[model samples]
Target: MTTARRIPVAIVGGFLGSGKTSLLRRVLTGAADTAVIVNEFGEVGLDHQLLRACEERVELLGGGCACCTRRADLVRTLRDLLDDRDRGRAELRRVVIETSGLADPAPIAFTITSDPMVRHHFEVERLIVTVDACNGPAQLAAHPEVAKQALLADELVITKVDLVEPEARDRLAAQLSELNPAATIRTAVHGVLEHEALRASAGRAEPGARPDGRAPPPPARAGAGGHTDDVRTLCMDLDRPIDWLGFAVWLSMLLHARGEEVLRVKGLLELEDGTLVSVNGVQHVMHTPEHLPRAAIADPRPGIVFITRGLDVHRLRDSLETFQRLARAGAGVSGR
Candidate 1:
């Protein structure tokens, strides 16, 4: 008989100096026998060696983020870990991947969720991101990749808050709220949080819990730009319901044309025909369109969040609406 699958496979990601390692150290100290995959960008993985106690089970795949140059290596390493558990050499309970600070979380996440073998043994419990409170704002202003990390996280953790002034803290919180209003923001000092709340999500919805706790409330209004330490995130909310077929067509074209730059697209769309679709995409690949089992009719306004590198929001909005309008016009004629 096959053993039951486990939960609590978390991804601890953040920009450089965002306290990712510090958080992992805390988790490992408490959760024993947990499997960890560490990816480092430097030639020498000194950080991996630093975690002395976890040496035996910890696997290091240093070189770059697994999604870019070392994707195959990542797949192979995970395969080996699965094999070990089957052979009874190690009893693995949970898995955590600490991504490089500059890495794009979407591709790494897509691999885990899309791969057949890995999906069977592991499920993505949640993505936890650490924000360097002192410098997060400046970083987002300069680096686009950092913005991607903030947007993709399920939970946003503000690290090194003690280092910054209270004024800076307020600004950082406001900026983070704008960038990833979707994720729950928690402050951490020396990397400590209540385990139940920190890891409460555990890759499963407890009884009627919704993922990410309902759709991110829409941005107050259309914004020109929002900046973090290194990148920017643009949010747009449609005042009226959207035409589903047209939205699909526009999304397909957008992905085909700018997939690499498009890190992630997640939104709740109200269809013209009265059904609702929760659509999410990572780079060029998109998850099969997921229809909500029930309608969120109370909130009919469609909301869209896009994480991209160096894309003009105004231009994108124009193109998307144009495609949507064309699609709807065609549908109207067909109905007659």
Candidate 2:
């Protein structure tokens, strides 16, 4: 039996009136072999109408959010899309899901990675979230869902920058960086972004590193302006190589215990075997680790950034250290 090709999926998410549709319209312009799935929370869906001009295969899930009431529909839609491709009914090289403004993208990601049939044929490429520059700060502070959306995104696009003053835009960008230090932040005017801005590779520059391969200044700590939630960013830099087995155990236990609190975790680590591995996860769902070339990462030291809610960073660090020590001791016993 021939193995089926897996399709790449990108998720576009943000809060209400955050310009998700505008960004989707920009993304689909002149792009071929791409299928779009739009989820709107109201009974009367309208975003699909705006997107139809650019895409031929537009699937709409109306009256429900993709992360909650309509998740099953999402899975069914994805399966049908795959079936169509196999039957030569649609030319689908990529799939983009434009989630409702009020949707939390974590569940959508969890669904894609957890469903056996869907996981076999589809993989999440990246999550792109839009923030309304004029209202982002207030929205982020008032809405925990909005904060979660920003925290879990791989790429964050601040839209309507033209409406905000330069100082305001810069402040919002800085705040978002603190919320998600690992995410790549870009500004969009009138929902238009450079073609390359949305590409996965554009944000591949290692977090905390500048384009010139130098480490940038550290961002201010999270928890400013009375965020109303416990969300914060915790960064850890390890001087020694990680024991994969121990690190895995620590992470598994952490997520199993407090998956919802642990919003997002991402980092690069040098293993005891001298291999560099990139690790990323959203809530309880973890992506398969990818091996990387040392030259690709500007920093020699291994580091991880955790975006968590109501979790103590000190306790987390200690727990991980204890697990690593135990793992190394066990390895020594086995070798002896």
Candidate 3:
């Protein structure tokens, strides 16, 4: 008989004071079955203690950041969870790792995909980052780490909007848009975000995307962008499907030419052959692309989204458009 497969893992990351803890608390309380791994139990101990009565599977690594110092512990903990699932002792179906504010998500993601023992049992479902609406712009300007966190996210959540004025909220949202254009950002009140929307923003497969109740599509507007320090981000949309080989060549060239200046790039793209592909990049290094089974009636088109620091958007856009056009024209025509 075959053993039951372990579920996917979700990494929740953000800058300091970015409401990651609040969001975790809400998810822990609401989720039916889950296991959480945090740096220290005491860090968010109050909330953890409050939810202890939920009878959920919980594990805490008390010493260091899960991505760096405590990485071994993380591997061990996840292995144990898999063991339990195989033994029918625990009904653990998902895992969430709330990373430290200073953590870099790329290394953590790399570890998840590359670790032999953990890789077989679990896959990375999504990278979610929360931005504090009040301090987001200033943090982005003053800190490079803040930009890095936002760059790695599949979805960006703009938290604490009610703390500021209406106009300030709009400006904050705008800034988030400019810094990480590829991410899907939305406002939340306390921890009562539309779980389905947040999950959908991350992607269709990750936890929190499907709540028990019905949900509406998020407002059809581009996310807001904030200006911090000298760094900036630009977000754009492309309605056409991309040529797979051309896209590969174009991405490689772009990374070689301007990778150092790029912070992150994430998007859900449609290949010319009618398949959906999820792509993400941090600086010049990109993780392997994850392809989804094609939906019979869904449109296949490229949705270009980018997050760059100290790069020119107009020039970049022009270059991308030109390459896209050229790539389309040359595809399947043989070598030049």
Judging by TM-score against the true structure, name the best candidate: 2
TM-score for model 1? 0.68
lDDT of 2 by residue, 9-72 (tens): 8988888788877777677776667887765334223333222212212232323332222256
Candidate 3 residue runs with Cα over 4 Å from true position? 1-6, 30-32, 46-70, 194-241, 249-261, 283-288, 292-301, 310-336
* Cα-based TM-score, every candidate: 0.68, 0.83, 0.70
Higher-lDDT candidate among 1 and 2?
2
Model 3 gets an lDDT of 0.63
Local lDDT at 147 for model 3: 70
**Each candidate's root-mean-square deviation in Å?**
6.9, 5.7, 7.4
Model 1 misplaced regions, further than 4 Å: 1-9, 26-34, 40-70, 87-94, 113-126, 138-148, 163-165, 179-183, 194-233, 239-243, 272-275, 285-290, 295-301, 329-336
Q: CA lDDT of 217 in candidate 1? A: 51
Query: Please, what is the whole-model Cα lDDT of each candidate in the order they appear?
Result: 0.62, 0.72, 0.63
Which digits, one per residue and each the tens of the lDDT, describe model 3 over residues 36-98?
A: 777776665435321221111223222322222225556767777778767886667788887
lDDT agreement of model 2 with the native: 0.72
**lDDT digits (tens) for residues 1-336 of candidate 1:** 978754346777888888887777776775655777775334113343212121112222323333322245556667777777789867677777777778766655656666678666666666788888888877776776777677676677888878888688767766666666545567777877522232221111222233322344533322214543223444666656788767877888887676666665666666766666666555665655656644434434456677665677668888888887887788889989
TM-score of 3: 0.70
